[model samples]
Target: MLASASASKAACNQETLNTTSFNYVNDIENQTVHDIAVKFNRGVCDIGRANLMVDVSVVPNVGQTIIIPGQVCHPDWTTCVIDGPGTNDCLIGGPRLYYTLNGDTMWKIAGRLNMTLDAVTCGGDSCNTNITCIDGICPGGGGSQYTANETIPAGQFIKIPITCDIEPYTFSAGVYKDLAEKYGSTVGQIQMLSPTYNYSYIANEGGTFPPIALAKNCRLLSSNYTILS
Candidate 1:
């Protein structure tokens, strides 16, 4: 009986060892499976890398819209509060060059600028019509008419016709002569039309009054002549 009892105790000890070994293997397998699942989840959510790029040079002028790429962070870095290029709108208005004339006819301004009437009026109404006549009738004239030039307010602004010449760039009697010759006008007529220009010569440049003939040839590039009150 004693031998049989000892054998039974040994068999029970063996059974316990077997159960512990199986449990250890199962625990290790479960841990490995958990680690793999965690890694798979991270991979699935990862955004990886972005190959997109923004080219600022391609942006169009203002008032025009453009489509920009979207990223994990806002792709419009220019507009973003953070990580933005900088403040102020990136797009800008188109190029605009304008000139104001004080005379009524295109021919007058053309003569002033030393340009042909056709050249100055090439753009039609906007180039040739007066600012007042843009919407309302011109004062002192009939038929809802607009002047071909801007109505400069007295003492508000001065409009002068300037000419770009190759030699004697400064305003002088010789320059005036060149202008008159080019524009088919008399020196006296030019002097009468632009008396302010003559005054500017005495006041600003401190030069003696030039000959009326040379003054006629002078081409206007800029003028210091101001409107009178």
Candidate 2:
């Protein structure tokens, strides 16, 4: 119901990259379909609302394989564990640009949007400030991370991240308020997206994931032409 979160978050999706294989082993001797189904239920939350491709029936044995999810995996992230709060699912979405007005501070802009410094910065430690570049919206030389004191000139477009949460369940490691705050949303909104622990007496059921949980879908178009020899 928070429409101000914008359509820009919905503008991009990532191409499935080839993964370096990783999986957890169910070393028990007689693992059944039920066992794997329990594991399958723990699959990645597809960020762009895509259907996951599963192939467990073909190899229902002691050495079950599960591909680690996402466009890329970090060095520390290796195996899919039981009830893990581990997957860092960020969509490959294009930033929505914001223009700097006269006397605009990076802090002010970030604060207004509830965006983290990590979201808007150009990335890397230092940005190009030469050629008369002012503020942290340093265009060129690989944009630097946002700094608190950057004095942006008027008419400069700042890149704002289209942040999204793609993990299937609420990962336990993060501060709940930060996530809600970062997206300019509420903790209830986050709770609404993730599966929650339920009480035994309540007859509650989970609805489909909130559409806002994902980044806007992105696609790539490629073309090929054959020239007459």
Candidate 3:
């Protein structure tokens, strides 16, 4: 179906970061998934998979939010939310590199990536002790070290701890139980992976979550070992 409004007016004009695979766009007017996909220069299936939308052929409700994949920021921007080697290639978890965006804080970064503040601050189980910040403000700097809540400037790359590689998921109208079933993960593990949301609250559905980190079937190899021993 065609969009009721002009495609140019309904275009996905949101800000994006480098390597940031998923982006959120609000539907100001009536449009089908195909219409939105065409505006974004992507396939309907790709958008559906990224957003976990059930129907790709139907027209979306007005003011509905949609997720677009493979959209990127300008080439000059160094900021990004690195999602690892994706789900296809098996790899080990370690410090994932994330370049800071303007007005970005450790907590915001963790929430944006579906990670815990501890993981972003290098104090959690996912952090590799051997790998520390080489360019940005790190955990320890005698007196200049910034806390997770402090704002970090753009273009500074930071190392984030990870237990396993991850794949992104957008939450629909579902609880943790539904999310766990969909991803073949336990509710507790999912909660840990996404600590930004309080488990007791059920109204927070239809939001984006940190990419689900892989625990099983990880293909370990010498090349995945990017950390220096």
Candidate 4:
């Protein structure tokens, strides 16, 4: 797995976003958007929005055509880090659209993204208005937005407020401080990812540590990026 990951990274480096164009493929194996993104070393949201998928996480029908966009790294892959408001933890390049799946709610979605409900909703910035509704029927308009937590019906694509991209990692044998130092993260940030853990206690052998988002270059997104930045 390590060898394959390295090769994929090498392949990704060879392809630049400026020179690469859209690549088309057929879902003969019945793959999801995530699967295609991993196979092509692109971001899931990139392929999802490019194909205008109502549910980015859903698997495409067999033989359906999918469009893969050119991206330098997976949306969750952080390239570099910059000084930020909190602890200088790594943040994603920009916010990515999260399409609601069945049984999705505000609290559940926030937890999956490892974000506080308040941060997910309006972390220091006002809520974004550019929502793309599925089924061609928008809920609210004319200065009134549908907003979060109201039914949160499936197939709705909402812009996730920009936050750090978290990757799950298991600690070999160390306390929170050791893991944080190894990953260039802070203890407070690590605790946020796995709040139940006792940071001071040494982790049990083979016990998996909480997920962490490594630092990366965070080029703030402008207001006008159509799908993703």
Candidate 5:
């Protein structure tokens, strides 16, 4: 009787260990699906029936599709279809839309959105403030306007005004120094206004320096800066 009890206890421990390992594996697989969705710029549901399989592992490549068999949940395991890919009718969530001004400091975008730059970028290394034009176009009617401090909704297309000139010459560092020397403004203050250049090669070529507009309220000390074409 003592040997039998010990054998039963060992079996129970093994079962528990197996259960824990299965749960861990399932969690890891779920996370892998989520990460792949984000990386591919596709929706999670797009994985379709292939994502619903149980006791099965799948490795998908870019542009490849797979099918999964549906498994039973806790309440109904018998009725589940385990033979084939379940369904392709998964619905996609809407695209997340946000806005940024070219060459504006990250702090300014965060302040405008009433969110930290870290929050906006999902804590990524890329700077939120230095976003380029191709990120998205200014929405119709000048995009969604917000007060200097407003919390923007996720997936809402924000339209920030392209107030700064795409001056041929001004880069962020140059603008910072120029504003400091001429207007007695600090680099932080100058960066609040978004300054950008229209031509990419000009900025790369180190040609003529252009003056970008200060924010709407900034007073120009000289008439040299032209409105970007």
Candidate 6:
């Protein structure tokens, strides 16, 4: 419920974009933050240009008290992953769920949000969403089955697997050792999904990895960190 900005700056704040999106409570002239970023598909991240009372003529009158930023789509939009610039895999929007607090893991919570590690350990079929069954002998009710290096505790909700319009490739500097010898995969297996950029800092900032069959859905963590970097 609180730990959103710790894990080494949340593995690089991957588009929870300083997190928040309540999804309701309109007042900006009866709801005008692009109608709360289209009801809640979110993208407004927020930036009043400079605020000379601009945008929708500077809303906040009808009721006054605008803040909304606590919701981001994921009741299961058919368990997204519309790769290849199609439009579905959160990228920087949301496949949102996020709950865990105390030093949350899962590859720094899917490397903040740039997602990888088999899409947060849910992999191809995309996991999470058990619901805990207990009486039924706990199946979906108990949820949080997790695997890949497991740990994730806090409140444990996590289910972010987004993928809209594909965008995650960074292999600069002599081109990631020649794309790891043409996708045979090495260079520490492409830095196990690039936990925080490497390969000479993504070729001195030019960046462009994710190629070998979508970087082979990485997520190779073992030396976790939530801060104290």
Better lDDT candidate (2, 6): 6
- Ten residues in a row with the worst lDDT in model 3? 74-83
| Index of the highest-TM-score prediction | 4
Ranking by TM-score: 4, 3, 2, 1, 5, 6
**Candidate 2 segments whose C-alpha is farther than 4 A from its true place:** 1-95, 122-146, 162-229
Give TM per candidate: 0.21, 0.23, 0.27, 0.28, 0.20, 0.19
Q: Distance from true position, residue 216, model 1, in Å? A: 16
Model 3: per-residue lDDT, tens digit, 14-99? 56322345444555544656667666655555555455432243345565556565643221011122222112111133334445
For each candidate, the alpha-carbon lDDT, in order, equals: 0.25, 0.31, 0.41, 0.41, 0.28, 0.33
Per residue, candidate 2 scores C-alpha lDDT tens digits across 1-229 of: 1121232234433353443333445466555333443343322222101212111111233554333333332211111111211111111222334555434455544433333343334343222121122343322212144465566655565543222333444222222333444544433223223322211111111224222242222321223211110
**Runs with alpha carbons beyond 4 Å of true place in candidate 4:** 1-19, 74-229
Indicate the residue-level lDDT of 85 in model 2: 16
lDDT by residue (52-131, candidate 5, tens digit) is 31111122333333322122111121122122221211101101222333222333443333333343332332222333
Pairing residues by index, what is the TM-score of model 4?
0.28
Question: For candidate 2, what is the lDDT?
Answer: 0.31
Off by over 4 Å in 1: 1-105, 114-118, 123-146, 149-170, 174-198, 201-229
lDDT of 4 by residue, 32-124 (tens): 555676677665555554443332434465656565555554343221111122311112332345555544454444443434454444433
Off by over 4 Å in 6: 1-34, 37-43, 47-64, 67-97, 100-112, 124-156, 159-229
